[model samples]
Target chain A: MNSSFRVTALLLCMGPLVSVLAEPVPDLTATLKAAFTDKRQATLDRLDQDETQKLCTQLRDQVPTSELSQKITRMNLATVKPPADGKYLGDWKAGEVVASTGTGLQSSDDPAKPNGGNCYACHELAPTEMAYGTLGPSLKHYGKLRGQDPAVLAYAWSMVYNSNSYAPCSNMPRFGHRGILTEQQMKDVMAYLFDAASPVNQ
Target chain B: MSVQDRYISLVAACTLLGASLSLPAEQTSEEAIAEYHAMFGDENPAELWQLRGEELWKTPRGSRQVSLEACDLGKGPGVIAGAYAELPRWFEDTGKVQDLESRLVTCMTNLQGLPESEVLAVKFGDGEQKSELEAITAYVAAASRGSRITIPLDHAAEKAAYALGESVFFYRAGPHDFACATCHSESGKRIRLQTLPQLTTSEGAQAAYTRWPAYRVSQGELRTMEWRLQDCLRQQRLPQLTYGSDVAIGLTMYLARNANGGEMAAPSIKR
Candidate 1:
């Protein structure tokens, strides 16, 4: 047999082997897009992950390296926008409402209604509320423990704006940064944490 | 009494008081929740759905006027014993990896000649409206009671499905930046009063996966695994997960595979 004929036979033998060896990786992006549909308040675009989220997802249960963690924190911290009017506190009563209420941006939620902080879902905000979660530490006496200094107030504001700023990959939602809570609502939540008369302080 | 005798009696009384104080210390919240669930005992409402499902399975219906007795659940036709424990497998006829719900859709459409739309119309049950799929899932899952979970991942498709599921579990997106891992990757964590299972570990996966297709007391409905995934996504503030979608099957495959060697105990009662 000629050299060309032998080469053709070799190529034919290797083709099926290569195909068998190369397992097809499912197109997850396409699969995810196809798997869900747009609903009220929640659209298909919500599935799109930002850089920080993508990195966190890649890490999964594993802790990120300190450098990577700091990078994420810095990226998220940049998104935190302090109150424009320089007022860090709002009505404590309204803040209490925001902290307790859990409905907001959910598919079933009405878009017209204001969003809630849902702080009690992962925190012990007040001593009276019996059904607080243990995922986060008890912030029972937040303001009482940390005095009302400008630096402390700024830290609290930034923390709520983007929890990843302090603890990267925190379970807490980025209320201000993600548009889950408005500037007024976040101010109210801050009051709930800092106001001397608020239940959180008591 | 003598001074020595009085001193000894005082010490004994103090010891008794300490023991009594320690004996009835308050129960942890987890213990309390478990006790509350146990109070229901054999009064699981899922039994009603299971009965309805069994009837649906045996009775002849649809355009073909055939019962689901001839339907194959990865254990040949008409065999339901321990079938669910080995599900989310590769199906030759459909050429896809399917969970219990998706596989039923196929059988209902192909064997019974029911329209796919009609079969999938009601994925979940509401107060007045009932879902036939949820009922059927209860019946099928019950059949596998005490059977060990054994997702072999032997087929290439099954492996692919498992991989997709792993990615889905870890993929964080949406407004809250939450994935299944956010709440479920840690041990002894709670979201409000509810105790979350750490599904990353085998113990957590087995404990959680085996008790699905439960009668949710809060909703007054029997919920299937598919319903669980759908609701979870909704709570995550993400788009609505389509019924019987690939992501749903993939997630189920991942959870079920992690629960390998665990005994099935489905159609259980839940809060």
Candidate 2:
């Protein structure tokens, strides 16, 4: 198991049960198949599930043994790669654009064009941006609150790269791990989070 | 803005002043709701997002000078359908955990070769840039509609994230002292005509969580579930949440787990 998984296994072993079983379970997979018909710029192949996904599906959110959770977490953690230049911070202004862009990864995109982060979909970052969402946590003081500890920076990096690495079923996109953000973009986003000048700290 | 209210007020004022103040009455709330639906129709704009997402999946652009057909959606590169259902899972090739959006970005940058910074520069939910993400998300969600949400939360990091997410959900802030739970933890609350679902309850949370990437009639755009949650915070008079923050995902995980078995109704229409 990767280090992350080992740590998760240890942590979950000590934590309370986290699962919340869904009731009145519909024939979810079948419903998915039936509801989604292959169309232009959309397709049916996305309906399939992987092995780990199946297990997670079966368990819903009640995580099984802590060790197993760690195994999974660590395995994913191994995937993160720091920037080529070894810098984790970027221009938060540019990062704001990355955070805002919610494009790419679909049939609608030129495919030749780049993708956006759609960060506002879940995060509350800057104070001035009136239109925002709350599905995620408010990051208004991300930098000011978290401080620039190496652990904090790394953790943030990992969270942006692959939130699932830290939370198996996390809803946030793995900006770096998933390749949604470039090293520079990741740095820019990092700046948006850590830089005192960024609005997130205002 | 009710037609009947306008008519009544006009009639009363005219009667008081003894002047004819005849005008087209405004629509009733029910009529207005119906008008909204009629204006909205069954066809969600999100469908357009799904359509465009598919195009982006194949067409060649970006610095890589290659089409995304070779990129994997967890099924394998170029695999479109059903890939999203199993996401937030670990991938060894990249050696990192990824969600649908992040993975798609990987494909776009690696295979397409768009400057990651340029692509990341776009805004969320508006402008030309946000539209791309919406279309792609709609398409991806459409790809996995009906599939179970199975995010592996076993990683130590994943576990930590859950801890973080759980903590974040209970966190309250803003001038009015708001938390996600403030409106969602309890059942059956609303601002005006809008019924707020109780997210603390499994049944209500699932209902709220499952029906996202929804077409918003009010905004005239297709928004993902993420947008739904973030917008709620904004309405609560809180700070603007940046795109893709950890606490957001943690909170989302909390909600997702609660809504696990709800059939995916993504790309659904909303008011």
Candidate 3:
């Protein structure tokens, strides 16, 4: 065969192989939409990614760039709404229940009932709780060590309101920001952390 | 004093003091759990499900009154040994990448003429709801116990599925803002007392993936990978994941491919 003809024939044969090898990436948005269906409280809209989620998802297994992280933190921090009455603390006894309770937003959870902080699932609060998880830093003596300074209380409130405000892509849930906990419930939890009489402080 | 005598005295002293005898200070919770598994020692209750699965596979039912003996599970028809390891592969017949459960649904619908609804009606058994699919999965996985996971991403569809699966693993949404990576991407982390496996790495993926289709003692049922994923999404507070969906297959492909060289050990027992 002529040299030109040989090259042309080779190219034609490799065409199918190349096409087969370079598979088109599936549309993840469409896939997720079709894969998940509304169940009770969790709607199809839950699959919709916000700006922070989209950025975080793209940066899978990689920490966000410092600039991007700060931007995300600022954006999330902007969403935080402090208590209307300016009271940061409530009943610590009630807060203990909020921290221990691990039910809310889940499809199996009852919508009528109140949501829980489920803090022990990731942090060690009261020293007596032996089964506490270690995902987050120990919160034992949180109030004892860090006194009730206005700035300190504000930081703690923001952390509960939206964890991403400080650490973008945090595993901790955005309890107040996401409506996972009510303002009153959040105040109660704040008390649980800061009250000197609270078991967490003890 | 002998170890037994010392232990007895310790227990007695604790009982007299109205204090509970706790695990040895040196024995971590994970080690204590490992010791609990050791007590079962070849006494897994999964065997009961396996036996039931074999019977279901061999029995002739469905509209066609044919058995799944002719079903092609990546390997040729009726060749089940080590076939599971190469699953979520390209199937020209369906023109999609399918995991074992999805493949079984295909075979049941095509070969046995069983309705897809009936096959997927009772996905996981609870109380009175028994799953023949779980039984069959146990049987098939048991057959490939020692085989290495070797999901061939050779086909274009398979490659696409793997890519999609990886994305799904890291995709975060919902009220909780959690993804599979949230709980599973970190090592030595726990949600309460349950250990979270870091699935982004090979060792973590293998450790987590190869042990599914386990007999969950807590649930009193044999759970499959599909069930595990569904339950996880539920906990993440995401919408209910559709059975045999592309995303489901894709996630399976990602985990199975990541667990490429690990030995299969499904139909195992778990807390």
Candidate 4:
């Protein structure tokens, strides 16, 4: 058992009923499967845990061994496809719209509508937006600070494409790998971060 | 105007803006927000739901045309005051550890002679359909206002539920590799402007658990604990949690037990 599990076991053993601690926690995966059903865009397939997901579950987002972390990062990086036409920038105005919208994949949402980047949900993209979330760092002066270098552009593209590539088990969703955002939408968002005229730079 | 005059005016404007921006001594942004919240606490629209709930509890309805006054909430039949503070307890009659909503459904079915399927089908209130469940939950939760939360763990089942809940809270899955702990395990974190409560610790859990079953001003609906769990999972990209499922009950037991000494403030208002 891991140190955390051992600690929990010890705590449970200290309780009045020793027998209860020995009664092994029942299998929950089966129970979870039985409890959930398909509805709208959310299907039973969403419950299927892959290798990376299973490992993350075991680690609880705690930084795992260097080897395992590297493996997860490598695995996710492979899924990120560079823009098809080698164009890494799109309309900043369109990007702004995508970043602000928060609806898409939810079952209650309209499936026919295109997905939103929802960037403001976790990041400060513009200095004027006072109500931005702080879970992710403020990118208010992103382009102004980073400059319009090719390497910097590529780095930003990959970060949004598959955040786990850089920080394994990151809270940021894999917008590209998960198909949450289209290539065109991602390009527009890149422009919003890189374009000199964009409010993000201002 | 002369350049010197413009510069002096600019400096004065800058100084004024800086003073206005500066926070008062020893007060955190959270504290400032708390004071702001306190200012509007009395105007909470949740009172309307409670009034409706009180009326429903006494009125006769359902197939049997009987009021829910006879329902035994594990505190004996019709004993409601202070009962919510010690809930998700082992119910001897049902032989299952049930949360308030589950128990209410049981009572509604058994005591009031309503069909379980029918009650379960009418999940949430949308428009004028008006969920009876929401009204009843508001009434029951309000009854325990000021009473300390003291969820019992005497039963073996209750203990197991707590353990399972702790496990589930940390359990990660779905497309984004999100768990409840991913956002909430740490203190002083926010996803956007919404501050995520650290549920692993007593201070955080107590603060969060007490204020749920809140009237969401945005939704214009009163949301229950069960709805909170389901919605959290939905955002996690997991399939919807079955209403009043064992998973939801287990999670409730874990949170409620942690909030042992916290005063009940449910049917609270939320943005």
**What's the lDDT for residue A13 in model 3?**
39
Model 3, A1-202: lDDT tens digits are 5545654664453222112132434566777998999999889999988888889887775666678888999999999999999999999999999998988889999999999899988998989887777788889999999999999999999999999999888989898898999999999999999999999998
TM-score (all chains, Cα) for each model: 0.87, 0.49, 0.88, 0.84
Residue pairs clashing in model 4 are: A133-B192
Q: Candidate 3 DockQ score?
A: 0.34
True contacts kept of 3: 0.71
The lDDT of each candidate is: 0.83, 0.60, 0.83, 0.78
Model 2: per-residue Cα lDDT over B32-63, one tens digit each: 33644564355445655676778876688886
A1-202: candidate 2 lDDT, tens digit per residue: 6555754765554323345332322443443344334433334444444343444444433444567667667876888887777778889899888877755554344546666776765577888764555556778889998899988898988888867578764445556764556788788889989999998899
Which CAPRI tier for candidate 4?
acceptable
- Residue A50's lDDT within candidate 2 is 39
Candidate 3 residue pairs in backbone clash: none
The docking category that best describes candidate 2 is incorrect
Segments in model 1 whose C-alpha atoms lie over 4 Å from true places: A1-27, B1-40
Over 4 Å off, model 2? A1-202, B1-41, B93-96, B125-130
Candidate that beats the other on lDDT, 2 or 3, i.e. the better one: 3
Candidate topping TM-score: 3
TM-scores, chain B, all models = 0.87, 0.78, 0.87, 0.85
Best-first order by TM-score: 3, 1, 4, 2
Model 4 misplacement above 4 A: A1-27, B1-41, B60-65
